[model samples]
Target: MDRRDYLARLAGVAGVGLAGCVTLPGSRVTGDDLPSVRNATTSNTSSPRPDGRLPRRGEVTLPVSRREMRSPLTRDHIPAIVDPVFGDDWDGLSLPDDSRAESTTLPGDAPVIGLTDGDRARAYPLRILDWHEIVNDTFGGPIAVTYCVLCGSSVVVDRVVGGSTTTFGVSGYLWRSDLVLYDRATESLWSQLLATAINGPLTGTELTIRPSSLTTWGAWSAEHPETDVLLPPPQSNTIRGREATFDYFIPKYRRDSPSVIGFGTDSNGLHPRSLVLGVAHGDAARAYPFETIRREGVVDDDVGGLPVVVTVAPGNTLVAYERRVERQTLHFSADGPSRLSAGATRWQRSTGAGVSGPQATHDLTRANDHPPMFWLGWSGFYPETSVYGEDAN
Candidate 1:
């Protein structure tokens, strides 16, 4: 199935709806009445399978997902919460670059942060950033902020945009627990899934911190002397309460094939509501809502880590086998089995399903000896397949 058709099928359900506005939980309510699937409390799955699916070697252990439970915060709670904030323009923002030699050092020459090219850089602290690597911090005005509580260093990215020079830090909404501060960018709070902390009610002095990562929170408290860090408050509503479970399986169901999992919700009886399946891989991160889906109790490794990527269509229960391509790489061919050929210097696609239709115009090339890469020759059935690679290389 093609991407457009695959999406149409996934969107067929009567109750489910896309989150149009990037508002927090309360502001926008989806119409879909998808039942809840209370399978697990978090994204951790384990089974005694012979197959090596989990992050660890043993079948009994699965990698925990990098997601956190989120509840809508009261207006009073949000005022002082230290979270990262974002700006609209990409160019105006100050981002880290190669010049950060002393500032971006790790514990043991680990190269925690590195410059990608002209402006962008990647920072990763061995243990500290791993536990709390990806966070959303807010920037106050003019200063771009990127602080690692674990590493105890925050860098201001130097960027020039719209005739104005700017700097940025970890956005408040980066899903980190700390309240990020920022300036001059006008907008509403955008939502993040699988974030470390969802900024909630702000009126009090108490900080709602989780038990697992006390050190991370402690560092945050030390840095912000002027602000108060709040702990996770008691859940007044069942919708926001945290629960735990072991195993959950969505009744072997199929609505549309080639539908990748979109955003999930607390709708299903499982811990995570349901998997949001879409056609084709584009904006895979933004395509599905991690917070909403973790509620349904799927295999922990499957849900938490989002390990497997399969292609299937409605009425067909089994997911089609496909290879994982980074992003932006394309392959086209008139002869040979349709598959994704990787490791090439340039993106050259070769492979057609040998099917006749406008959809057959796309190419696929198998770079391996396993199974021949096949493209379901209809857009209506499967579109969630990964057509475009990440960088388009």
Candidate 2:
């Protein structure tokens, strides 16, 4: 079907009467409902198994029935959509040379998922991810880099599960408005936000979270010139076309949208759509609202009884690090020539490495697992989370 016809049909399905405005079934619509619109375009590019059929549900042996599987969301509410993007496993994945990348193609403000391991770094632009939500690739090691445009969640996880390295694919399912990933090895379904297998043989298994950053393409490319950026696989021109056609439909899911899923209420009174850097240390979880941090620049806080510092660097990159160095709790501030300071120590915001001071050789431990996500998704997953601000709920 043509793009216009398909979009009209999709709008009809969602009861959207206006051209640019999309309204869902509920009285209130948030970013969660925005990705659902991709369901129509997704079917056009969804990858099939090598045998030319959709992978059978429960293809892997499981102790429990598929229908009996449960997660934070109702199993019945989980819609079985078409993969539409990265079908099967690692389909359309690519490694493009950063030096060779055409900077003119990506806008400076365009979002990109940044990942680094030692000297190896890469940036996956959202323009590509808007079509394929998952990229199973190796850079210094096996890793699955994922971005759920629906939930505004970007995470990079170790591909190895239970000592066995496996690739992942989009399962064409959404749990609590988050992407559901399936391992090609066991066909086990996993939640992208929770980073845990929710069904199939590997149920309850957790994937190791890796340190990554979500920032603009210009900022990331400037920081790591040698980093390889993912480009659309030549075979997926159709997917790329669909992304362009639907570009206008994205703002409805932007930070201003009223659409939200799960616990829509923000106990801290922060806007449900506000962006925040969510930190979960042990049982303690807190959200550092970007609005406040953008104003203050740096925040010194504690999570799970461990002193920590959250810094917002130039280009709006957000990172959190443990403040304890050799068992000494050091206070930090952004008011310095280096932009970060703990006493006489100068620190680099990108690597959390001390540049100069008595602790010049020390590296601040990073709380990499903390996801910088939308307030709606973060609070939904962590209902009891505290907001880091004077007006916190």
Candidate with maximal lDDT: 2
Write model 2 residue lDDT over 1-393, tens digit each, in one string: 432333234323222211112222232334343333332221112244677664332223222233332122222121211122323222234333323333335566767788787886777766656545677777766888787655578888888998988877766555545667788788777878777776666765778888788887677778777776664444233312322222211222443565433323333546545778888877888888887887787788899997889878655767888889989998988855226788888888866877888987988888647557776567556766777884642
Report the C-alpha lDDT of model 1 over 1-393, residue by residue, as the tens digit: 433543344334211222111123234434342223233243222342466443331111222222321222222222211232222111232223422223321222221221122222222221222222232222222222233221122233322324454322233221212223222232112111111111211111111111111122222222222322211112010112321110101111121222224522212211112223322322232122222223321111122223332221111111221232343332322122222222332222211122443333433332211111112111112233333121221
For candidate 1, the clash count comes to 123
Alpha-carbon RMSD of each model: 22.0, 11.7
Supply candidate 2's per-residue lDDT for 97. Answer: 38
Candidate 2 residue spans exceeding 4 A from truth: 1-104, 235-267, 336-338, 390-393
Each candidate: how many clashes? 123, 6
Worst 10 residues of 1 by lDDT: 243-252
